[model samples]
Structures are given as C-alpha cells and as structure tokens.
Target: MDHQPLVSLITVNYNGRAFLHGLLESLQACRYPHLEIILVDNASADDSVAFVRSHYPQVQIVENAQNYRFARGNNIGMARARGSIVGLINNDVVVDPDFLQPIVAAFAADAELGAVQPKVLDLQRPGYLEYAGACGGFLDRLGYPFLRGRLFDRVEPDLGQYDTPLQVFWGSGAALFLRKQALEQVGGLDEAFELHMEEIDLCWRLHLAGWRIAVLPESRIWHYGGGTLAQHHPQKFYWNFRNNLFLLIKNLSANRLWRVLPLRIVLDGLALLNELVRGKWRHAGFIARAYLWLLAHLPLLMARRAANRPWIARGAARTEALLYPGSIVWEYFLRGRRRFADLKYSQAFTRRLAYGRHLSPTQMEGVEQPYGTETV
Candidate 1:
C-alpha cells in the first residue's frame, strides 16, 4: 500500500447525457492519485459522447457501433482498461471523494479479494439504502439475491448498522470494484445475461474460483437505482427470472443443483400464478416466457455448467455454506420478516468463512442479530 495502484473507473452509458455531469463532477473530486476514467458509450442516441469529449477531455471514451447493453458494454471497457484494479460503475452513480481509497486498500489487504461493493445509499432518498445494493449482497438457498440493508422492496435507513467490512456472496454491479487479474481468471461478465443479474453471476464465478467478494462500508456511493430499466419494466422481470436460472445452472454443484432448481421453477410458477390471479397479464407473460426460454436453451445451459465444472472443483469452499439455509421468500412474505435483522435463519450463515477469516455469530454481532429476538 506504499504507492497508489492505478485504478481504472469504467462507466457504460446509453442515452445518459443528463446524468454524466453529476457522475463526472463527483469523480473529479476523488482523492485517489492514480485514477483512470473511461466511458463506454453504447451507441447513445443523445450527444453523451460529444458532451464528455467537450467537457471532460481527460476521460477516455470507447464507442460501440450498436447498443451492447450492460454486460457486454462493461466487458468492452474492461478489456481496454490498463490498470491493475478496474471498477465498473453505473452512469447514474455519484461517489464520495475518498471511496476509491478504501476499495484499493481492501484489495491491497487481501490477495484473494476479487471484488468489493461500497455501501450504496439512494440518491433521491438521502439516508435510505439503495435498492440494487445496500451493504453488499447475499443469496438465499434458492438463488434469490438480497442485500444486507435491503431485502426485496424494503430498504433500511443507513444508521451505521452495517458499517463493518464483511464478506458477501456478490458485489453490486452499479458500483463494483474488481481486480483485473480475477477478471482474467474467471472471464468477464457473461454477455448472454446482457443486463440484470450479470454481476451476481460474475461474483458467483469468482467465489467458485477461490476468490472472495465483500462490501467495504467505509467507502460509499449514492445511486439513482434504475437508470436504463425502471423497476417494474417488463424486461427487468424477464431478465431477473431468466438470468437467476442461468446463475444456478452455471454455478451450483451437481448435488445441490437438482434439489434447488426444481424448487426454484416451482416458485416461479407460483409467482406467475399470483400475477395471473391479480390480472397482471404482462407480468405473467414475462414469467412464462422465462420458462419457455429455459426450455428452449437447456443444451446451452448444460454446456455452461460443464464449462464451469473445473472452477467448481478448484474451489475449497462449498457454495451452500455461503448461502442462507432458509427461504428468503417464505421468511419475507409468510413470516412477515421485513428487515434483514428480523430473519432468524440468518444465524446459519456464520458457518462460512469471509475474507479468509472465520466469522461466527459473535463476530457479526452488530451486523446480524441473534435468532428469536424479534417477532412478527
């Protein structure tokens, strides 16, 4: 940590001209000495590239001939990145001046650390946690990803509840920090994902390759949440459902995959049924289409699974050890556990090692409460 390592900050933009000023302005105030900024423009219809060229001439620009969406756009930028540490930041996010320092320090502290996510607060809502990634991300037994400070639609207020740096299942894509070596080892974000859940998929591979992912709460950023696709967008639903299945297929061990996947499909069917009962035809259609896509692409998914087997065998840790043993969906809806603290089964997650250290329930005291302390 004697000398600052060169850090490349890459942001993918698509018709995000209006958001560039805030993001670029905030980055200009960053305290990090060795910093490189790159913007990957995905054929933005707006004058986003021209505006950056006119205003921020120091920033590097990579223009795509057509819209490559999130995953591929980021991959393109990362490929052009020269720094040892590369960051994939969203165009709509604004960071704290000292954010890059902590991220760099975390990487310097742990050689196995593959990725890190800063504590993300909502830009519009002040102290509330951002919906995409609050204080890192964790997955339930069923492959449902949720955050420490935000579960489903419930986002917690940033009251220093999760201030400690802790190991997590995945880092948020909105403002994820990555080691260039790790990216090379596991490969870039899956282009097939195109958008949602791609970061989770990448982190899952990192874990399988014996790399650690964590949330460094000391560094922070505020996100506008949905810049390209709105929360309720039909495409978002399709990608979330479809890519989640892709995630499980590609990463889950053979012993667990059979048990978990069928249950996940059943849950998706229940979700589709609920939407149908509510007369939400579009939502139901999206879910149904996800199933159809799965059926049509079974061979492709099997190939991806076969490709990832070596990494899975190389990993010393069990994927299930890092996952919450219970169902997040049942705990949230059926048991009425809204806050992350209210979930009793979270205590089971202490079995996993984080950042090369064993973390017991006592070690994660403030971050997670003891079981049965609160009731519905």
Candidate 2:
C-alpha cells in the first residue's frame, strides 16, 4: 500500500511445533505480497529449530538465549522489524490469504491509526469467534477490561453484528497490525508484563500519546485459543491478575485513585472471595499476590508516571472519551444490561459523571482512569 512494503508479519512461538507448522504453512500459502515473514523462537526445548531449518528456511528467525515471555519476544521482533507496519501474529493463528492487503491499506488511509486487529474465530469450532479480541477491548475506570459486545470472560457468539469496522481502545496481539510510530512512542510492551494484557498496555500508551486503534472485521484469522496457557492455568491467572493491578496503578492519576479506593477494594475483595468459594485457592492467592506485587512496585510506577507526565500533559487540561468510564456502575450495570433503563440514582451528580455522585470516601491517591486517550 502506498508503494511501500507496508507490512511485516511477525510470529512469536514457544514449543508449539505442531501448531507452528500449520501457522507457517498457512502463512506461506498467503497471496499477500510486499510482506516479510519473521519467526521469533523463545528458546523452545522442542525441535523448533530443526523444523524451521528443514521446512521454512526462507523465513527470518531469531532464537533467544532462554525462554523470553510473550512481551520480550514481541519486543525483540519489534526491534528487528524493518517494515513501517508490523503485524504481531501468534504462532497458533491461521490467517486468510488476502488478510494483509486490507490491513496495510487501513494504515495507509489513516495517519492517526496506531493499531488494527482482525476478527479471530475458533480453529476447532469454525465460525465460533474467540474471546481474545471480541469486538475490540475497552477499559473501565478501575482498569478492568470489557469489550463493546463482550465483557468479563463471557464471550458472545458471532452474530455478524460487528461486521462494520470501528475504532476501539486496543487490539488483540494475536493477529494485530500496528504502526511503528506508536510502538516507538510507547516503547513497546512493558517488560514487566510477561504475558497477558501486554497488547492492551501497548495500545493504551499509544492512545495516551494521541494515536488511534481500529478493528477490521473483513480480515479474519483462525485462532487456537489458549495455545500457551489454558483458561485456568496458574501462570495465566497470576499474570492476568497482576498486570491488571499494575497497569491501573501505573497509568491513573493520584487524585482519581483517591476518589475510588473503597469501591476498588470492595470489588477486588469480592473477586478474591469468589475464587475462594469456588475451591480455586490458588486463584485467590494470585489475587492477593497481585496486590502485594503492585504494592511493592508502587515506587517504580510513580517514577514512570512522573517521567511521561510531560508528553501528554504539555497543554491539555483533561482528556475524556467514551472508553473512559466515569464510574464502575457503567461497567457493572449500564454495560450490556437490558434492565438498567428503569434504574435511577437517588443522589444526583453534576453533568454526565456516571457514578461520581456517591464516590467512596476512602479513595486512594493517583487513581486516574487508565482509559486510552486515542480516538479510535
């Protein structure tokens, strides 16, 4: 697109020999031109090296000294990528033959576009969509994640409802294509986040810097969900819980955090309690450890906030967007709840603030919203 080799499809792999073969084969079979194929192996103990050497010698490869987690693997690929647009594809995905053409065209059409994600369906279940990038991701005020058509872990089956391409807060890293500028600005995925939510964090920083993200419904990919970690895997639980808390504290302002401290504590406590009741003792421990990890890393987060304050705070007073919720009520009830219409708040607040009318008194410091400032 635009006469440049616009896209570099980068795949990250770790011990997925069987899956990797299918991914590579599908990739080689794609019709899209002006693209380079890259594979980043995170020091797998399997015969991945020999397999690549035997079957896919033409593709560029990077072998890490040890197992680099998803974040690091992506970062390494980013550093090595030569194209202006980089496609961060998972080794477990099989994309359509013509997928890259429209994706590259999307970036060419919009200067503000930072990232675009494809609709990922289940490989085993055919038309069934995966939960990873359900109609693009959004953030509640307290750093909890929700999508336009999906929330929590409840995935909505594809009804062909999200067929129109629209701007979203973030893209799923699985089959995402991102502009190079945003990654350079945000400094790639935070190394602190080894696995989950790294793509969202990368897009959040991009948005904060005034970039945009979009979902291309026309482009499709089949994802073998839970390739690296199963749904209830302990490491998955740990990283998901830990990164949620870390990102919330790292991104929000001190004043906003103070305004909703009690509410956040109650919500987190409930989550911990639910885990305990369901006989998921380790899940509860992960939640507690997430808090403990964030508590210990508060100083580092504060230091980061101080440094980036100059970039966004240059001349702006307050940043606002639909993606940034005024309160958790918007998340819990107003979001995806058909019966929320008759609900009325007893106490009235000023203007359009959702649940700010009855804010908790024990709000913590530095808790501004973690919503991306980008338009898309």
Candidate 3:
C-alpha cells in the first residue's frame, strides 16, 4: 500500500460546457499525485471538446461520433483507461481536493471491495444531499432503489450522520469508483440500460460476483443534479420506469422475478392512475409506455436472465443481506416514510454492515448512533 495506484478519472459530457470549469478546476487541484483525467464527449454540438483541449491540456479527450449517452460513453472511456482504479464522475460534479486518498485507501484495504461512492451533497443547496446519490445507494426486495440520506424526493442535510464507511448494495454513478478488474469481470455496464439505472445494474452484477460496494463519507463531492436531464422531464420518467424493469429482469432470480414482477406491475398501474388523477397526463402516458415496452421485449429480457443464471445461482444465498425485505414504494406512499432514517430496516440490512470489516477505527469514530435514530 506504500505506492499509490494510478487512478483514471473519466467524465462523460454532452453539451455541458457551462459546468466544465468547476469540475475540471476542482480536479486539477486534487491532492492525489497519481491521477489522470479523461473527458469523453458524446458528440456534443457545443464546443465542449475544444474548450477542454484549449484550457485543460492535460486532460485526455475521447470524442464519440454520435451521442452515446451515459452507459456507452463511460464504457468507451473505461476501455481507454490504464489505471487500476477507474472513477466515473459526472461532468457536473466538483470533488474535494483530498477525495481520491480515502477512495484509494478503501480499495487498498479490502480485496473484495469493487466499487465506492463519496457522500454527494447538493451544489446549489449548501447543506442538503444531492438527489442523484446521497450517502450510498440501496434497494428493496421489489427492485426499488433508494439512498441512505435520500428517499423518493426528500433529501437529508449533513448532520454528521452516515459518516462511517459501510458496504451498500450500490454506489452512485455520478461519482462512482470501481476496480478495473471487477468491471471487466462483470463485463462492464449493460449498454441496453441506455441511461437511467445503469450504475445500479452494474453494482448488482458486482454483488452477484461477490464483490462489495461501499460509500466512504470522508471523500466528498458536490453535484449539480439533473445537469443533463431535468428532473421532471418526460424522457427521464420514461427511462427510470423502463430501465428499472430492465434492471430487475437482468439481475433477479426466477423465483423472485415471478413473485416481484406481477406485484410491481400492479403498483405501476396505481402510480399511473395517481398521476392521471393529479392531472399529470404526460407522466401517466410515459408509465403506460414503459409497460408496453416491457410487454414487447419480454423475449429479450428472458434471454438476458438466462445468460445471467450462473451468477444468479452463485449469489442467491446472500442476496437478502443486501436488500431491504419490505417494499419501499409502500413505505413511502402509504406509511409516509419520506426520510431514509424514518424507515425501519430489518436485521438483514443490519448484518450487511458487518461486510465493512476493513473500515478503519478513525472512519467509525464519531458514528455514535445507528441508522433510523436521527429523523429529519
């Protein structure tokens, strides 16, 4: 651990010129000595490539012929990366100068650790957690993804809670750090995901391969959330609903799939109805479109599940340890658990914390209370 491993930091951009100054400047000031920055442009009409080349000459640029969006763009950049540890950061994110040290230290400490995410706060809102990735990401039994400091739309403030480095089901793609070997073992990101939920899908595959994902709060970043796609955009809604179904199909086991898919369809129906009742016609229409897409592509989804069967069997026994046993949708809508700390997780999640065996005493020092104790 004496010699620092090379860290290749890659950011995918599509006409995001205004945000580049903050991101690149912060990266230039990074304290980690062994770091290289890569900028992957997705055929932006804006002069994003020229701007980077002229201003940040040290950054390596990879230009795509067309807009490949998130999954494929990062995949292309990762292919060109020579670092042992690869970090996929969003173009709108600004990192702390010493962020890379803790991330690298965490990987050096645990051989099984495959991915890590920093505690992401809002760039616009000083104290609040960002919507994309708060402390770390997790899932419910029903394939609903949520974060430690964020529920559906409610985000918690930085109050010294969630300070410990702990194992999680997934890390946020906005500032995700991964071992290149693990990414290759999992065959990299599933490009079919296109945009939304791709990182969660990648983390699911890593879990299936018995690699742990964690959040190191000591390394921090600020995200200008929804820089590429607006939060309420219809396309964002469509991708979220559709890609979530894709995620569950590609990763869940057969028995769990049958039990969960039917219930999820019913819940989606309820959501559509609620959206229509609230006069949100476009959102409701997109939800229906997602269902139609699922019906049309059943064969493709089934083939994907079949291909992943071997890994599914390998990880089946420990799956429950990473997932919340209850439904997050029900907890959020019916039980009024808006904050992540308000939901009561089962013992399975508690046991999952034991996976953080490599966490140093200093990292766990001030974590005086367990989760669900401090409700905002």
The models' CA-based lDDT, in order, is 0.85, 0.70, 0.85
lDDT of 3 by residue, 1-376 (tens): 4459999999999999999999999999999999899999999999899999999999999999999999999999999999999999999999999999989988888777899999999999999888999999888878899998888878899886777777788899999999988999988788887888999988998988888888998899999988899877877778889989899888886767777889888888888999999999999999988878888989988888888888888875454356776778888888988877678773345444644535532232233232222110
| TM-score for each of the candidates | 0.92, 0.84, 0.93
How many clashing pairs does model 2 include? Answer: 9
Q: Write model 2 residue lDDT over 219-313, tens digit each, in one string.
A: 88888888888866765767887787666555555555555456777878887898999999988998888888878888887776676566445
Question: 1 or 2, which is superior by lDDT?
Answer: 1
Candidate 3 deviant stretches above 4 angstroms: 346-348, 354-376
Candidate 1 regions exceeding 4 Å error are 347-376
Q: Is candidate 2 or candidate 3 better by lDDT?
A: 3
Candidate 2 wrongly placed segments (more than 4 Å): 260-262, 312-320, 324-376
Per-residue alpha-carbon lDDT of candidate 1 for residues 1-376, written as tens digits (9 for 90 to 100): 3358999999999999989999999999999989999999999999999999999999999999999999999999999999999999999999999999888877887777789899999998998989998998989878899988888988999999877667888999999999999999999999988888999989989987877788888899999978999877876778889999998888877667777888998999999999999998898999889889988999998888888888776651444467776789999999999888678765455333244322121233234322222110
**Reference-based TM-score, model 3:** 0.93
